[model samples]
Target: MMKIIYTLFSCLIFTSCFNIERNCNDYKTGTFQFNYMEDGVEKTGKFVRTEAYSIDYFEGKIDSSSVRWINDCEFILTNLHPKSNQEKRSIHMKIISTSKNSYTFEYKYAVKEGNRPDRVVKGIAKKIE
Candidate 1:
């Protein structure tokens, strides 16, 4: 029993020390492709991001958003020209993990409204340029 407990503790310590790679700065300003499912259809969107702004091209329309970085791994994005009430809300985004050419991120509305619960969506983006 003592040996088993020691082995389990050692495993936990080793796993805790492992960290995911996050070279966020390298992804701060780039063109990237994100694939998602919408209405049961797989869709791809491309976006160009700078330090302060981002332009997204999706479904034959271009939308722009202003970006404010809270840190190297997190930021908030506000739509520049929102056509609906929901679009006017700011989105909070965080990079959960990263790789050589892609990063996994989660985003949600920054502010809760009405009785709707906050919803977080996670996706992976691949750098294209």
Candidate 2:
């Protein structure tokens, strides 16, 4: 029992000391690239984000969204010209971890739906410029 307790305590202490690096400020205003799957096909998209807005280019279409910062590591993105009701919803984005020129983020709809749990998606974006 003592040996097991010591092992568990050591693991808890080691994990508490490990911290993920988040340099979200470095990615606030830059061009970034990411990949996503749609209809079982993989596609790549590029976006340019400023402090107040973000413009995305996918395929030949362009979409714009407003950026409302919640903090240095989190923000809300609302479509500027939503074409449908689903598109009108705002997405909450949180930067989970970051490297020198890239970041891993999780995002989901800001508003919850009736009787349904929120679906969060994680992705990585690499800064291009």
Candidate 3:
């Protein structure tokens, strides 16, 4: 019995399967910041969640287009208008684990292929007044 239960638990964790009510209430609704490592360099940014579904980002002499939430933890960023064939890409962020004031998140864009196709973004955000 113990062996069977352990095997099932291992399978679930390794499969990246999440089934929890991490609703909008659990996510912070205010300004936050994160440092991203891109191209072997680090970039810092300040992000704001105006409401449950709206966002704006700025930091380190850089500001980005508005972002909006699609679901509880998922968000879409439109950096550019509908120019040519691309209409801007979407970024999906999910809370993999959390404490009271912080959460571990993973981010990825919907794409076909590349090295590290699934890039995990570990961010720690704090709520502000």
Provide backbone clash counts, one per model: 0, 0, 0
Q: For model 1, which pairs clash?
A: none
lDDT sort, best first: 2, 1, 3
Local accuracy of candidate 3 as per-residue lDDT tens digits, 26-101? 6646666567777898876666665434344544444344556666666665553444344365566666665565
> lDDT scores for all predictions?
0.95, 0.97, 0.60
Models 1 onward score TM values of 0.88, 0.90, 0.55
lDDT of 2 by residue, 32-58 (tens): 999999999999999999999999999
**How does model 2 score by TM-score?**
0.90
Candidate 1 total steric clashes: 0
Question: Which parts of model 2 have CA positions greater than 4 angstroms off?
Answer: 1-12
Q: In model 1, where is the ten-residue run with the lowest total lDDT?
A: 19-28
Report the Cα lDDT for candidate 1: 0.95
TM-score of 1: 0.88
lDDT of 1 by residue, 56-100 (tens): 999999999999999999999999999998799999999998999
On TM-score, the stronger of 1 and 3 is: 1
What does the lDDT come to for candidate 2?
0.97
Residue 110, model 1: Cα distance from true site in angstroms: 0.8
